[model samples]
Target: MRYKLGWASRFGVALLMGILTFSLVVTTAPTQIQGAIAQATAAARQQQREQQVRQVRPETYDLSRYPVTDANERHWRNVLWTTGVVEPQEPYVAEAIAQIVSLTARSGLSRPQQRTVEMAMQIATQLYFSNPTGYAAIGQQFLQTVERSPNPEWSAMALSALVKTGLDPQQRQRLGDRLRQRFPQWNQDIYLFTTLRDLALLQQTPTTPPLGDLLKWTIAPNQVHLYVICRPDRGVLCQTVVKDGNGQFLRENGQLWSIPLLLRSLHELSWNFTRGQTPQGIYRIEGVRPANMETFRAYGAYDLVKLFAPYEEGVREFVPGRPGQLPATLTAYQALLPPSWRNYFPIQQSYWAGKAGRGLFRIHGSGEDPGFFTNNNRYPKSLGWNPAIGCLSALELYDDTGRLQQADMPPILNALTRLGGRSFTGYLTVVEVPGADTPVSIAEIEAAINS
Candidate 1:
């Protein structure tokens, strides 16, 4: 294997050479040469300073003094509802999940309570995944669900869920055969047709999504890295190398942003189902919500960039950034990708997820500071970052006195912003790439783009 130097190593070498050249020119070259060399060195130093400034990092805050207010309650409550935990009863599970997640992030979680919460979350998600189409009940319950449910949608969802869970073929089909007989007319139904077509896909051998020439990121989409954030020079994306699909380096107006996001949903359930982890897929960026209109303590001060799944909620509204209309069919949505990544299944998750009745995903900053909690990190890999109800959440730094300081949402919104201050009708694709514990670093992104 060829040995590779990291960004720091490469920079160190370049700095060394620049220093040596400057020393030689200053010591031995004539007056005019020395003056020219001095000017060049100063310009280079200024450029380096500006380049470092472009790689913006959010300021950290101490939140221990701030009390865990109703915002935390409301955030967890929303999570509970997303996980199908809504009821007249208090959301005990949400509390546990929140506690576990917070604890896990900053400090080690060895409490039995942590195990209890994990098991509870696991059970809740399992119940959701298994019952969606209704075969996990087995024997009488399974038969009755398939045969008796009047809703053809339920039956279709059940069969598709069965396919997704790797249920036995013969058993799945036996129930599916009954489902077909029950809903023979459902073949024409748009929702069922879309779902069952996706089910047929499960039977086929799964292919790995291609790492095309574009460094299309499948982020757990955090680390606040933007390849295209700009650098003052005619929109040249200064240092750091992540190329966009059009084979050009991207710029975010000379200011690269880092929005700490965890694609892992608070539910931490299966990706394909509703309220699961942020599914690996491409979504349409319609615009940023000018204001949340709710409590700022949960959502923060940044405007949320709204995301739409293909054919989401049966509406294809107009967007100013992209020409023509929204994609209505799978082929059209595939048009969202470069020709190279069209067949990649993971890249198309938002489409199927939308088909499965999941939407309302947005890119927003969080207000739930983990510093106030004891245990809340079973799912989010980042420190102090909170999970979402399937929305892409960016990190929000606040002051010790409970005031917002820095956020990751604004730059992303800025990147997607269009002429007339409209949000771009562009697409944001998230993929779960291989390599355990691997982050979407600049080198990795460059390698994929160059490859």
Candidate 2:
């Protein structure tokens, strides 16, 4: 009985040991499997990170080697849109597009090819604004390229982008329309002409002449205003205090003149004309009268001297006398006038005289009289009078005659500066009427003009 009991105990102990071993295997197997799964997941995650990095890595491109043809422009466009091309460590896609556009435009390509590049640039600009990722970098590059581009389209595009980012929809639309109309062909001539016209128009008051008429009369060279004209024909006629047959003030054809030709002649005389052989006293006399020497001293001679000095260049020899001095040949003066002003003399004369008196004198009255507004009234308020038209006319005269000097150009410059002052900076706002009393900053105005 003792032996049988001992055998049963040993069997029970063996069964218990087997059970313990099975439990140990069951618990450790799951732990091992879990560790393997964790390591696999880590490896997969690392691989994905590496792949993403590679995708965005910069690839070398031979930009110069790529032929800049209209057909190839599409390829450049695609490069800009490709994902991950503008990563931080990579060449910026926006910068690349700008470079491509500029190079393509200036590559001596055909008109169609140039146009294609412009279209591509416009599309790129649109994309830049639409997505606006890394927009600051994109904008900086765009501005740099635009300033360097000869194509007007690039400038217009840059301006539009600025408007989009800085201005409200209404302002943006208005400016965009104006820019589109002005730069329809994207050539320098049209672009520069439109820019000047728009700048002049902005300063126009209700009393200003029609835009067409203003353009016909006003001439500008290097963006400065010279002289103003009233009529376009009979050559610039005026009433000045000259020594006349009766020693009285008389109105006559003082001289035939334009600004551009005058400046050219003056420059020639100053630097190129033969010494002594150059004619003396080229200005013609209109009349002489019992006049106020004080008036002559205050404005007349000074004004004429300042007006003529642009052409003098230290070579002009003039007859030293009273306010009324006549010259032998007015040919030099006549040549300076714009071709558009040749037949419109009547209007040109009136315009010229009116401006000479600082819009303070008028011809509407029976005799030359003070304008309705006093000189005191000629402050910022008086800027409303067709000052833009007058200024533009003056500029035209200067441009035609080459009389527009860097100095003595404050009045015309003031008109432009004031006009530009009506805009807002880093943003756009459209005022339907340019002369509205809306307050604007000088900086904003400058930005709008430059843009």
Candidate 3:
């Protein structure tokens, strides 16, 4: 939500200041001046990326159009699965599992490389929907990955996988205790702590939100139900829906605005858990990001509402565009709403997730179709609605002549703008409400809203 001078502007200002001094060296040696200018420009750009990263944890592609390369088949496949580009079935899932197995047999790995750890986590997450709770298939094997190095990143992910295995509670507790003792040395790592916290939480049941919490959040302007469970009858479909309109948020002027957020991501991970698909919780609506070469094929042009999770690293200063005195604690996050809402668990999912270290997020449309040719998707993929890592993706369709056929994000933009004007700063609450086995029919949401 915060804006700053562009890198070019900053560089220009610095150059102007330097020119005003009229240095003899600058006048005499053009090459040195050019090199200095280049260095200054490079430094300013890097600073900008870092600053932007704190508030908006955009995909690298979003930042600078970095394309996924398949020079390394293992990495490419993992990327495909992680990005939801490919479904978690057949050769894709099988091959990704094989890559993790292969990583184990290799030698000369005293410590896992950064990419190695990251790719492993990526595959491990999607593996949940594929393997379910007892992630037994990949747990022990990846534990070896963690044992290879005591590094926190590897340790955090490996331990996360291990906790899902049949590890005893007492043993898990002791191990977790030991790790926390070592945390201070690593500057009291929050990711490590929260990662383990998620492990412990998975072992227990979540506190059920009161009915009012579910009702209010269901009709909230930017509601998204991204947590999904695959049932026998429904396959894998979103568990929440609305009544009057399939997906609309009512504005203050009493107008029914449609943002078309009928979304689905079958990342079996539960509410508030970012270790899964899109998290359930409060997010700050921080405007949009137009499509780039890396994202255009999947996400279309001039769209994408950036959702900033509270407590997200670098976004500590951002209070979601909700009313109330600004407070930043996990409990304080809910205080932005009415007193009655502070106790709402479902609406607070993302606030917890941000504190746990999953931050950069968005609500955008994708042109990619997971079920265009093959029915790889568990349920029918509506409007080419494919999955995104942790984003709430909507349908944005176009016709042959590039005429807009269907688009959902623009309305979402309008609704948020109505709530927060040009900055489009508002709170987006994602929750996992009732209903399973059957699809959340349009009637059900309408009934709920009307009542």
Candidate 4:
């Protein structure tokens, strides 16, 4: 009986040990599996997040793919308005402007277009100021659209509206001044002027010349005068002169000339003097005489010739003992120019002249000598002679000589093409005198031109 009892006790102990081991295994196995699954899921989520980051990274916009055109302008305008990319109260004003633009597009009608839409909204805002209860709701809606837009034109229009709403005089003046300084072009819009004038807003007067002058100067189209003077005492005085048909300078007239005029004049001058000249070109520098020895020392004669010769047939004729003779060291016509100007002349002259199958083709002066004469009649246009009509004169010369090339164009096209369709409008706005910096390269310029 004692042996049987002992056997039962041993069996019970073994069964209890086996049961405890099985329970421990079951609990630990699940925990290890769960931990492994969690780690895998976390790793996969991290990879997906990294991929998402890479997918949405901003890419450089290829301007060439979207060249400036009427269609592209319309498309971009629509995209900006529809996507609320420009204006804030986009839902309200967007549909209105879009409707107007759509009607114009479909009917092929010529409305004031963008400026017209802006003017209409501005008028509405003005009406709201007089009758706030009647027009305030719509004015507020349009104001919201103006606030949301990144477009400068819309911003100008909205600010104009705000001025119309009778803001504090000082505040209105400040805003008007800021807008004028930032966007001088917008200041020319008649709609803006009329709105400001009617509201008695403190806006700057438009810089446009009289209509008579504009019509008279239509021969020049858009041209400004860039004068470079080499005085006897003063070394060099370069000033960009803006002139209307009345022959009054812009500064003297107390107004900014049209930007188109400034740009055209700058481009024409750059093409003629810096680029080079031909019979077709109409720029000329007259009455250039030998300077005193001191004058020669202050401003290099060779530099002057190199600078001006591209545009004119520079002829220096002075005897060794001549009363108005420059220094003997400044004997060479090319040597008269500064080292920098001398070096740049050939490169610039060649770039324009060579491409056109012509040379700068100007005569130069010999050492302190007096027997130089210009065949002004041989090259009537090349002589330092410019007609009253600016671009029209040049065009007439090209037409008379039958030299206007149908295909060959200035190197500007090539340069623009290289810029990948970016407009040279800004860069071309400011006119830089020669010997400032090297102009853009031919290859790069070709790109900009083509674009």
Q: Whose lDDT is greatest here?
A: 3
lDDT of 3 by residue, 42-136 (tens): 34335533443333223321212322223344444434344333323443344344345435434444333334435555556456445543454
Better of 1 and 3 by TM-score: 3
Model 1's C-alpha root-mean-square deviation from the true structure amounts to: 16.8
lDDT for model 3, please.
0.47
**Candidate 1 to truth, TM:** 0.53
Error of 1 at 406 (Å): 5.5
- For TM-score, candidate 2 versus 3, the one ahead is 3
Q: Compared with the true structure, what per-residue lDDT tens digits does model 1 show for residues 1-451? A: 0111232242343334333433321222355433333322434435533443332221201123212333343333333343332211123333333333333222233444344333333434434342433322322222444566565543454454445455676776576667668778867664456555555555684655455432544321211222221111110111223223343444444422223355655543545555556666666556566533243435555567677776565334523333444555778667656666777765677767776667878766565554322123222235545556677666555444433344445445544442214534445556655443534454555466557
Candidate 4's TM-score reads: 0.19
Model 1 residue 109 lDDT score = 34
Tens-digit per-residue lDDT, 353-443, candidate 4: 2222332232121111010111122222122112110121110011112221111011112222222232211011111232322222223
lDDT of prediction 4: 0.28
Per-model TM-score versus the true fold: 0.53, 0.24, 0.57, 0.19
Which 10 consecutive positions of candidate 3 have the poorest summed lDDT? 1-10
Q: Kindly report which residue stretches of model 1 are placed more than 4 angstroms away from their true locations once superposed.
A: 1-147, 155-182, 185-205, 213-247, 251-260, 268-279, 312-324, 352-358, 370-377, 380-383, 397-400, 414-425
Task: Report every candidate's CA lDDT.
Answer: 0.45, 0.30, 0.47, 0.28
| lDDT of model 4, residue 153 | 41
lDDT (0-100) at residue 7 of candidate 1? 26
Q: lDDT, candidate 1, residue 84?
A: 35
